[model samples]
Target chain A: MKKFISVLMSALIVGTSVFMLSGCGNGEKQQELNVFNWGEYISNGEDGTIDTIREFENRYNVKVNYTNYESNEEMYNLIKESNSSYDVIVPSDYMISKLIKEDMLEKINFDNVPNFANIMEKYKKTDFDPTGEYSVPYDWGVVALVYNKTMVKEKPKSFSVLWDKQYSGNILMFNNSRDAMAIAMRLKGINPTEITKKDIDVASAYLKEQKPLLKKYVMDQVFTEMEGDQAAMAPYYAGDVAVMMSNNENLDYMLPEEGSNWFMDSMCIPKTTQNKELAEKFINFMLEPEIGKANIEYLGYSTPNQKVYDLLDEDVKNNELNYPKEEYLKKCYTFSDLPQDVYDYMQEEFLKVQA
Target chain B: MKSKAPSIPYLIWMLLFTIIPLIMVIYYAFTDKSGNFTIQTFKDSLFYTDVFIRSLWIALVSTLLCLVLAYPLSYVMSRSSRRGQNILTMLIMLPMWMNFILRIYAWVLLLQNDGLIDLAVKFLGLDVPLLGNAGAVILGMVYNYLPFMILPIHAVMLKIDNSLIEASKDLGANKFNVFRKVVFPLSIPGIISGTTMVFVPTASTFLVAQYLGGTGDKMIGDVIENIFQRDKNVGSAISLVLMVIILLFIIVMNKFGDEEVVA
Candidate 1:
């Protein structure tokens, strides 16, 4: 009986392995497209909203194997290591540039995706993709200071309020190195994008000085802390501030006068993709007016799709918190991929400040 | 031979999951991004010695706190009847069945400014900053790991012979002396095992520190995590160093346990 059991277990293992291997091969009638995106960044048809993935599958007769990543670095590492599985990935501006530089991303075939024209004129042919060949802009937002109006007597006009000793232990800062350092750089009147070792040292010193004033270095916890009046102020994305403001009446958001990081997350096909055409098709489907509208409505982030912007509610369209004016946009700087040594140096300095 | 045949699968599992991954870590630790053999990774990790020391200090404090809290509680539970012991053990283990992150989040809600504890303190006219400090992180570590310390000691305590305790008493030893000479000595194995279980995880924990600690309270795990995302070589080096440190710690603990046994 034991021998029989052992034989059966071996057969089951072999059978499962064979099944898994076959599953990866193109044996099915419908072609499969693998999509990786940031967590909670998409609309999944909640509350009678349109399920974009389902609509695309129904329209194109292709299946989408969807997954979520928490950060750009994580997604980049996975794609860099083994790019064959994922056809499409959504990464931020800096990560997109890194992938392009590393030759990990494929140039988009505009002929297959005629809907590429739907992207706003401003988002096209930018620094990240100089010729507009590699990526399609998906969503964009700016960083802003979120504060409880009741806590502070005066409006915080500059980033220096984060250093104010009166509000010490009542302020929150970004947990990540890039965003945290960018704020300090802007505060010091240095261009955050074009940073040097000296600039990093200056910023790290500034952050260390501000450390005592900080309540915490936080990420998603910003929502709970800010909304519950646990913190007086925090630097966070404008889109998340909108969500928090909707929940708490006392909460307000402002773009710092010094400048802030304007980030864009874009969808691109990796070089190792087996389903490039299907991936482009999926991208085009996402760019469709109704799909774009549903996504923007759900996400609360600014839409790069002009048609989606036009179709948004009048209140949403006018909400400066969601879509800041051109003047604000002019002052905002998008992050560029730093050299590996500089990146490592910045990380080391950031840790030193924390230490 | 038949029994050895069954061991083949287990050996393969160890090779595939444990040994290979460890080899990969060691390989990456000693190599550069270009896959050339280099010790630069280890040299770079040396720059963050402060973080390593801070992580060790915090973990040491939390482990000590867990031991202090758990020893008394486990003793009381052990002294109870079988049914009472089972109930108490279940009570201790019940909170663990819930998600660890969720439980940490619950603590966040309870400890944040104007939170439950804050509100209670304010009602009595005493205000305190509860969240986002070293205290909060240590509290979180102790709360999470108290059960780990308790369970091993509890298991060992259950096996402790009552006849030994009675004989100590009958030999004209007082209650405290009996506990010191008999109960405490007998429970050394449990204490050692429990210390190892609590200390290792608490030392490596990044989440508790990230969620509860202030900006100044960065741990080695966070640094390792950050480097792993950016450069795997540096991360692997730091991880290898961490592994060696932990191994050294275990060896020291085992030596201490041996000394206690000899005494």
Candidate 2:
């Protein structure tokens, strides 16, 4: 029995060493780049379309490691906690600002990315990266009120429709703190980016009042609930609402008269990146007209690439929901990183509302 | 004698994964973001007493429900033929083969307002709010944890000597007395293990409440998760408090089990 046990232990050690050695065997000569973006935010050559990553790999002779994240906060936390070196990450405006403030991001060398000029003038040098030094705009969209036309008697024009007692138990609110508080702040005509403690208290009180009327606070589940007609109304990104509207004709989106959030998700290289030049090459590849057009078509989001916008079909270009009038743009607010104290206060207040 | 050699790997694993991570949590719980020692996070966790109380109440209710459902089911399974027992156990484990998140999502589809349950109720000329409430959350918990309660008790029940039960009957004890005096006392260990297994996870779960419960049913797990994304220090502090509470509950339960066994 002791001899058998020794044989078993030797076998286990040999097996584990073999497994470990196999992982290190992939010492390929090709340079590797890691790209992390949002889930379902890219076009991957489904249905005979352009396979963007494969095209990049074949063109540049470099191996690409791609991953996806569900939320910016989740991506931020993972990058902060793990030593894993991600070359390129896509984060929204506020998160990009937070990363920049923490000095966690690397400045882009625009000379390496000559295609940076393909981005439109409007999307350049925004508040998140004031000098446009760290990030390249990937996609931009607005937050709007999505509602069922069949259920409601009139067109809802204001954010107050969410707080209407008649729609109690039929409304869905964003599950995240910043987006939920933004809506409440917008309803109270308070600037979401310039948040103060007093603003947080007032907005949180408003959210508490709105709590009983909510059916559920959700994030990605909004698509299933809204498309199934289980929910009558919710505040969500315009791009997602567009996807839902295509599946369910009864659904429509409205940009509330009280203004809304206009968010820009951008790609930035982290300071921990081991291959900065290759990361720049991948970013430039993403900005190519055909690649950008395919991504926007697949994701149903607005694009900042002028060449990609020109390549869009007339019907897509004319979709008012995708491209709202300039008058509406005046009221839209882009979020900036808040003071740490105010951010903490907002999170505490948001939790109090739920509790 | 070959002693203490086989357990070396297990001890190393425990030190690396479990002990080190726990120590890190304790360290973060006591310190600020700047690495200075402070008790502010622990003090901050005091304000979230409502969430803790709610989590405890929900977990207790779910554990009780699992016990109530599992006891009779396990008894029947143990009494069945061996072939039948195998089939029953397999059927109980079939749902676990699927991903846990997907299983919970299936419940979401069945329990929504216009979902399968609501549609069936409407056919009977009734309306029921089956989803987005405290009851839905408890039902989710019970549905997911019933197997944990059943497996341990069933294993224990299968080991009971049939002659002991016969002796109880021969002594003029009714079925109720047999169960109370013999079967119940014998099953205490199984019940204790099953309770611990079900109660601990339920108390710390955020997913079931998020998907099934309405706006008012946030748990301590959800608060910890939410805080973790914003501030890891406060999140670790809350987790430390939760760990202590669960550990205390387990110790108290073990003491009760020991006293009952001794009696």
Task: Tell me the TM-score of each prediction against the true structure.
Answer: 0.89, 0.90
What would the per-residue lDDT of candidate 1 be over residues A1-355, giving only the tens digit for each residue? Answer: 9999999999999999998888878575689999999998889999988898999899888888999999987787788776358999999999888998999889999898888888999887778888889999899999989999999888889888999999988999987889999999988888998778999999999999999888888889889889898889999998899999999999988888877999998989998788999999989988989999999888878999998888989999898888888998899998999988898889878877876
Model 2 is docked with a DockQ of 0.55
> Candidate 1, residues B1-263: lDDT per residue as tens digits?
24688789999999999999999999999999999999999998898898899899999999999989888888888889989998998989899999999988888888877788878988899887787788999999999989999999988887888899999899999999988999998899999999999999988888888888877788999888877876889899999999999999999999999999899
Displacement of residue A107 (Cα, Å) in model 1 is 3.5
Could you list the iRMS of every candidate? 1.7, 1.1
Q: Which segments of model 2 are wrong by more than 4 Å? A: A1-29, A74-86, A99-114, A271-278
Cα lDDT listed for each candidate: 0.89, 0.91
Q: How well is each residue in B1-263 modelled by candidate 2, as lDDT tens digits?
A: 77999999999999999999999999999999998999999998898998999999999999999999999999899989999999999999998888888988999999887788889988899887888998999999998988999999999999988899999999999999999999999988999999999999999998889999899899899899888877778899999999999999999989999999889
Give the TM-score (vs. native) of candidate 1: 0.89
